[model samples]
Each structure stands twice: as C-alpha cells, then as structure tokens.
Target: MRAGRLRHRITFQVPGEVQDQQTGEMVSGWETVWEKVPASVEALSARDLIAAQAGQSEASGRMVIRYRAGVLPMMRILHRGDAYNIQGPPLPDPDSGLEYLTILVAKGVNDG
Candidate 1:
C-alpha cells in the first residue's frame, strides 16, 4: 500500500456493551478497536450507489487500510465525526494478502 494515498485518518470500532455512567445500566455502543489509523476513503460511483441502494444495501464508500486481523463486517469506521457501517467482510489484496484491505462502507448507518 502506498503511504501517500492513506492520508485520511480513521477509527475502527466494534459493537459492545458499555456501562452507562449515570444510570449504571449496560447499553449497546461502539468500542474503539483502533484510533487514528491511516486509510484511504473513496466514494462509490453514481451507478454503483444506485445499484447498491436498489438492492437494499447502503454501501456507498470504499475505504482502504493496511491489513489487520479480526476486522469483521460488524465493525464500523469513524472519519471526520461521521459513522460508516461496514458493508461486508474486509477483503485482502489478491496479489499480496498481507499488504492491505479493501472495505465497503455505508454512511449514516447505525452499526452499533
């Protein structure tokens, strides 16, 4: 992966239970898995967006990051205060699997 292209900073999160400070009750929320991770975020093309939406899928963006284990579909990405739900499992590079991962993401979705 090219370091220059991965200029965008993003955070990876997974769904988990957290204690509500005031109420002392367990609430479902996002737990940070990695913070300030460098990545490349790109928007899907107009045709792709239309097709995804037509199929009841919200995948509208593609984000690429360095290869990391345990990145699941249930995880979400946080960029510039916007939450993006992971559309499917993270895909590794075909030629060199260890190099990077391509993740499909959707904005405005509550993954947690």
Candidate 2:
C-alpha cells in the first residue's frame, strides 16, 4: 500500500458485553480496539468479489480499507461516526516489506 494513500483515520470496533444501565443486564456492544488508525478507504466496484456479493445482498455501499493488523472480519469499521459491517475475513497483502491488510466492508447493516 502506498503511504500517501493512507491519509484517513478510522476505528476498529469489536463486539463486547457491557451492562445496560436501564435493563441491568449484559448487552452486546462495540468497543474500540484500535482508534485513529491510518488507512486508505476506497469505494469498491463490481470487480471486487466483496462488491459482487454485496450487489446480490442489496448492500449499496461497499468499500475496502488498507491498513495494518488489529481488526477482524466480524468487527465493524467506525469511520466518521458511521458503522460498516465487515463482509468477510481480511486479506493480507503478499507484497514484500509491506504487510498491509485489506478488509472488505458494507454499510448500513450486518450480514449476521
């Protein structure tokens, strides 16, 4: 990944259990594991496999982010206060000396 492309900052949030104030019961929520991580977010086209599947699933906004490790497939990407559900497992770049992570995500809902 080019360093210049990674100009935006995003957060990686994972599912966790927290006690609900109103219900006094454990509730599922997102907790940031990596915040303000530098990454490059690109709007995906149908050429990408994730975007192809997204089309069938009615996912309008499909994107791919390139960053270092600290996230997983089930986690959500919090960018500019908007949530995007990861579509599948992250693919690590195979190029030498640049161990970047490519994560596929779709906005508005979770596939689960």
| Model 2 clash number | 0
lDDT of 1 by residue, 9-45 (tens): 9999888998889999999998899999999999999
lDDT of 2 at 27: 78
Q: List the residue pairs that clash in candidate 1.
A: none
Candidate 1 structure, TM-score to reference: 0.85
Off by over 4 Å in 2: 19-26, 46-67, 110-112
Error of 1 at 96 (Å): 1.5
lDDT string for model 2 (12-111, tens) is 8888886778999987777778888878877666555454663345343433345455567778887887788876667676775246776667787532
- Residue pairs with backbone overlap in model 2: none
Off by over 4 Å in 1: 47-57
